[model samples]
Target: MTTQSAGEPGEQGGPLGMQIDHVPSEPGGSGTPGPPGPWQPNLVSTPAQKKAAAQAIEDHIEPDTSKAGDHADDETGKAVTAFAPKDGDGWVTSTSLKSAHKTWGDQVKNLMNRLASEKAALRSTGLLFQTTDFGIGTGLRQTSPLDGY
Candidate 1:
């Protein structure tokens, strides 16, 4: 006959042949409690809910073309003016203001590129949410706007 302790290895099907030393008590236990388990929400999203969520993400991914174009044009003008030769008769004209203007123009260009990259990343994420299977069995199918792209 084989005998095992109540909390011993494989006694109650504990993980990895290890015993559970302590069970979690209610709040306000003297000993420090273990980390919480993974969260499992009881609620499931309906088709309408899924559609609304996908639409919201899609809307958020849309870039403001007009504003982006205006900013790009303004920044290009500033860069051209900053690097242009001065009216004075000097071989090289390097002023603090010109340097600052050049720096500002470069910063503007960096900001625009960063914003575009971030938008592209967000759009890709949104598309993933639309196409990837959630495995929730809600019978909801999301279609990405960039499906053909």
Candidate 2:
């Protein structure tokens, strides 16, 4: 188990602020064997860090999507419909505009949903790591000769 210090809480380290302990040598191949010693955590997130990250996503990213989506809708829906009413001149262009508007709206909605899920995942990350570390530490402690004291 390699023991390298992790980044300070809430400080982004690597790209995406993530680490992977092992990876397969090739597709369908086994990953690096488990360490002979206790597990070492290379990435860590505190409760405050998780909360702030999730909150930032909610406050900044989620709200901006509406503004952006509305801009696209107005440009595509209102402008196109004005120039080419659906049943009149430039009807083909109007139909195309409607399709584009719907596609843009759907994409925006999908992005918002993905961001929400990511925020939820971020909020729970600290707790998940704490629980996992505690369980592993407890198991390792039980195997120690020091426990006989």
In terms of lDDT, the best-performing candidate is: 2
Provide the RMSD of all predictions against the true structure, rounded to 1 decimal.
16.2, 18.5
Candidate 2, backbone clash total: 0
Evaluated against the true structure, the overall lDDT of model 2 is 0.76
Best by TM-score: 2
* Residue runs of model 2 more than 4 Å from their true location after superposition: 1-45, 137-149
Candidate 1's TM-score: 0.30
TM-score of each: 0.30, 0.56
lDDT (Cα, 0-100) at 145 in candidate 1:
91
Cα misplacement distance, residue 121 of candidate 1 (Å): 1.2
lDDT of 2 at 3: 37
Which lDDT tens digits does candidate 2 get at residues 44-70? 667788799899999998999888998
Q: What's model 2's lDDT at 56?
A: 93
